[model samples]
Target: MYTFDSFKEVIASSNKTDWDKLKQVMTIIQTVQESKDQALYDYSETFDNVKLDTLEVMQTDLESAYHDIEDDLRAALELAYKNIWDYQQSIKISDGEASELYQKVHPLNRVGVYVPGGTAPLVSTVLMTAVLAKVAGVSEIVVTTPPQQNGVNQAILAACHIAKVDRVFQVGGAQAIAALAYGTETVPAVDKIAGPGNQYVALAKKMVYGDVGIDSIAGPSEIVIVADDTTRADFVAYDLLAQAEHDVLARTFLISESKEKIEEIQRKVNELAGEQPRAAIIKTSLRDHHYSVHTVDKAETIDCVNFIAGEHVSIQTKDASSYIDQINTAGALFIGDCSPEAIGDYIAGPSHVLPTGGTARFSSGLTVNDFLRTNSIIALKKESFKNMAPGGMRLALEESLQAHHDSLACRMEENK
Candidate 1:
């Protein structure tokens, strides 16, 4: 069982920013920028250790992917697609307060989604990123995933089909980010790049930030479960492992007022984690990243939860919904016993692409808002224009922008 530590100290240690990796990541990005598709071929051989005949997966093969995958998976993907799109549509473009000057919403023309082909194929990510873009009316959505020994995963292909992703590329890592940002012969330049990837891919996104929009500097997946006496130790244990199974660095924590309750959950975690299929991964993840805290009271527990700002927060405490407003930093909240973070990861309406690394303090999970850009529309009436011009010209003159003031003067003169 894991021992409880000083919550502040444990949270501080998790901030592992690798500035050294910047140079190497930049080199990979530059290589793709210069070599284009041939660079993709070389990197495929060098990093992925798989040779590729073509950069893009053919359209026919993409559409036929549904037939190749299992019937259950296809059904699941289709259902998830509909749910995700529905959620996105619900939150989109509601300028309830009509004004003469309002925002004009427009979706990005194209986006590139990077699906990691590592430990798991991340088939759900296909729906999370692509379908949301589709709902936002993005013209084209392309996906980039690393290839496995047997080519792309059939389920991933099936997901692409279900999500209606326009293009699928067999490229990944920093090179994939580079190719997406600065187009290669096969992969066209995208307006933005979405989806999560490994550290190199994350660093590449950081490098290409200005050239193309990225969803976020995604860190490992995490979940923080707050339990009370009414909470089931087994449920908390499994939820902890749910996040732990993601990666060795994935964070999990149990915070409760009673030390006995925390200990019981830890004990349950030990018993359940070993029996899991990803038991080896779960063990490593817990040993490396899991933390425990014993809060003196409800106020202390709330403070701890806000400080961590976990990607997913599950409350099993009594009257959980009443405490929702107190914890303001979580990326997604799973309230009550029946609602779990795992549901949010899959069938839940919202995108599972939430902020990690305590960034939920300042950011939010992916949504239709992330895909939509807003432009201020100003068609000022003569009265409003006259009202604003005097102040605007005065400010422009004070700021030493003579041309700006002159332009406003010219307009005013023409109107008179």
Candidate 2:
């Protein structure tokens, strides 16, 4: 049971809501900041409930981990790895080699990827982040994830093998970010850090952003569905619930012009929810932040969708692709009823780590783009500099920066 709202109210309230709690994570530092080994050990004891003397995962352990995993799950992980790797490789490019003009394109020498470890081993995440770094031509990629039980999950080790991570560490949470940013004895400092994690991990990355590059401080997952009369109630309900199951904080919304469709979908959702083992989570998420809106027409539905700026958006109406073209914001667009949100999560070939909490309005889903950095190349001949000097000086003069104007003025005099 969700409530409807006009776009204006939602926008205003979202802005006014307290974000201070979320901001605090960036400020909090792990107790192990001074010593990487101690930090890892402390977090291991604190979060994972295990104390370990060694932080680095040995290759022998990795090999044994492969045997530890079931064959079917291993096959599934391999399939996911191949799909993700194949897709990322297509986007990677070698720098425009030997250009006459000053040009340079290259991957960072080192990068770090963080994978969550706790409730479930996110084997797919290792494929998503590490594989992309390799495709982007990074020389070295390292993985940092918490230990589960006593050690890394077997699936996680196998994924690391698939991702070709140069090093693996059994550390997680804020301390992991700090170690990657500052460099522990076993973990070398990386130029950039990428991947998703819980609140503490997210906050740590936010805090260490200036010290090292990081992906977005992702918020809870969210999905918004724009369904028409042609939409199946079951399809709409299931798709919305996919993101909702991520966490209770995750949000889901459905906007339709037809009141009957909205009611029918709600009924279907209620019926299906009872069967879900995670039903309580879904129910609370829907009851709290989720929305079911009855718009006046398709125009209003589009407006509502844009305002929500959901991480995943599905259009179950006719001309779904055309509607996607019309929509300005959304992390990922699933057109038509057949392509549900579930496909995007595991095997869709697109990275499921998307912008969340309305960040899709400005940011984007994770991609090879996130793993690559572009440096602008610029050069000017003596004549070019002479020609541009007067304009540069005039702007600097307008801004009342005498030194800025003088640097160009002196350069022009030297050319003469």
Candidate 3:
């Protein structure tokens, strides 16, 4: 594990490989744009090692997957769906009304959700993204994922059925993003795309931002556990390892003022990591990105946490809830010892798809708001138009937009 005396040194040491990957993703997207639907099949053979006859998953297959999933798994998906749907419903934007100005919120006509399925099937992601889109009343919710040797995972299909996704495509990587953005013979174009995946998919989303909306260019999973002498070493260790197991590039940080407590947490992390099923990944990630920082006080610790701007932050100190307001940047915050970061990933009311790699400073997690667009409404009576037109005409004339000024003048005259 690496030790940092200051958060500045940690930021300096961080490695960035997005630009290199962006070049490769751009090449793949260009190929997809040229080949259209054929590129998806070619990528499947090259990356997934499968020859596909059809690009879309049929409705019958989704029904079979629903039945094939075990009873307990179905129950779990239903529960997650309920929580996400309920939370999204409660947060719907209220229609604004006033004498001269109002606002209307409307769901996008279509949206595409990508679920990572190469090494592991991210079934939870299906619930986290699609359920919110459904609750937002999007007309169409299309899904895309990489296919396995046989096909897409049954659990993923079952989750799609439960989430009421309109369609599914057996495709992934930059090519899938291109298809969603530009449309093809089979995959209809979508207004926006949401979900997380590897570097390639992230770069693809970044590349296609203007053509279609995206949630965020999500980076590797990360977590920062802020604890002190009162914190439980075992809990801190396991949570760190849980984040580390996400990928070989995942990062975990421990911030505290007590040297002995840091050492104890590090020791527990080493011992518990060996017992995890993804021990190899956990070990590599820990050696590469893990950091332990010793701070002078709570203020310094909070500063370190804000600088890291981790995707998930778990505060395990005394009165953890009190620290929530102090944190200025983080994708998600878990207060108190009883709330584990893993719970937020799986069953929490908030969507698990969050900004990463210090992007929490500007971006936010996925929500029903992502699926809806707001439009400003303007309606003015003759008196209201007379009251407001001169100011607008003055601004338009100052900018030398003669057409804009003329249009406003013409309307005002007609009203008169």
Candidate 4:
């Protein structure tokens, strides 16, 4: 772990776009574009070691998934769905209209949501993206996930059902992103693509950005906890360990004014990591990515947080709530000791799909706005146009555009 005396000493990469993966991702995308679903099948077999005859997940599969999951699991997912849906409604924006100018909000015709199918099933991801799209009133929501032995995971399918996803495709990785960006024979093209995936998937999204809108190029999961001497060492250690378990690249930053507190948390992290199931992964991540920063006071702690702009910021100081407004750049702020970063990953109302690699500096988490498009309207009467023409003509002439000047000039002359 690196110990930094000041926030300026803390260093982080702003954009984590892997240019090295571009060549491989480009090849996959090109093959998908040429061979279409055939490439999807071949890649699935090559990577996932599964041979698939069909690409789409049928309605029967979804129904079977509902029956496959346990009653308790289903109930938990149902509650999470409602919570996410409620949060989305609370923050959704409305259309505005006036006498002459207005903005009309329309949902995209169709959208594609990519959910990474790794060792553990990402059921919450299915709910996070698809539910937001559904709330936005998207005409059709399509989900693409890595194909399993049966098809998609049962829990994930149950999530798709709960979110009212229009369709599901048994494809993942770069090829799935390619299929979404450029329509193939089976997988239809979508207006936008949103979700979290591995490096290949992230690079593919960057490659196909112009072809389709993407929520954000999500990086490794991360969390920053600003704890002072008053903070609980166990709570701070637990939060940091949870972050490291995400992956080898996942980062954890602990900023505190007290050197003794930082040392206490570090020791606790070392002790707890030994007992964790994903101990190896967590240890490797902490060894390489973890940083225990020493600051002069609480203000310096927050300054370092804003500088890093981590995905999750858990303020565990004496009065954590007082610093929430000061943290201008976190993807999501957990403003107390009780709110662990894990809660936001699942049961919390906000979508855990967040900007990483210091991208919270500019981009935002997935929301209804990602699926909605707005267009501005302008309508003016004769007097309104006449009143506005002279100013418009002056600027046009100053730019030496005679045609622009003539367009407004002729309109004013005709109106007179």
lDDT of each: 0.87, 0.79, 0.90, 0.88
Total backbone clashes of candidate 1, pairs 3 or more residues apart or in separate chains: 0
| Clash list (residue pairs), candidate 1 | none
What shift in Å separates residue 262 of candidate 4 from its native position after superposition? 1.4
Spell out the clash pairs found in candidate 4.
none
For all predicted structures, in order, the TM-scores are 0.96, 0.88, 0.96, 0.96
User: Taking the tens digit of each residue's C-alpha lDDT, what string does model 1 give over 1-416?
Assistant: 23234668657876876887878899888888888999999999998899888878877787788898778878888888889989889987854345769877888899999998867789899999898899888999999999777889888888998888899999989999999999988999999998887788888998999989999888888888888888999888989999998887788878888788888998898888879999998999988888888887888888888988989999999979977899999999999889999988888789998888889999998888888898887878998898889899999999999999999999899788
lDDT by residue for model 2 (216-277), tens: 87767788888888889998888777767777877788888888898999899888886887
Error at 147, model 1, angstroms: 0.6
- How many residue pairs clash (N, CA or C atoms closer than 3 angstroms) in each of the candidate models, in the order given? 0, 0, 0, 0
Better of 1 and 3 by lDDT: 3
**Sort order, lDDT high to low:** 3, 4, 1, 2
lDDT per residue, candidate 4, 1-416, as tens digits?
34454434556343445667889999999999999989999999998888998999887778789878999999999999999999998988878966677888889999999998867668999988899999999999999999888667889998898888889999989999999999899999999999999889988998899889999988788898998879999988889888998889888888888889899998898889999999989999998888788887667777788988989999888889999889989999998877888898997878999998888999888888788999988888899999999999999999999999999999888999
- Give the root-mean-square deviation of each candidate in angstroms: 1.8, 3.0, 1.7, 1.7
Top lDDT prediction, candidate number: 3
Off by over 4 Å in 1: 1-5, 94-99
What value does the lDDT take at residue 377 in candidate 3?
89
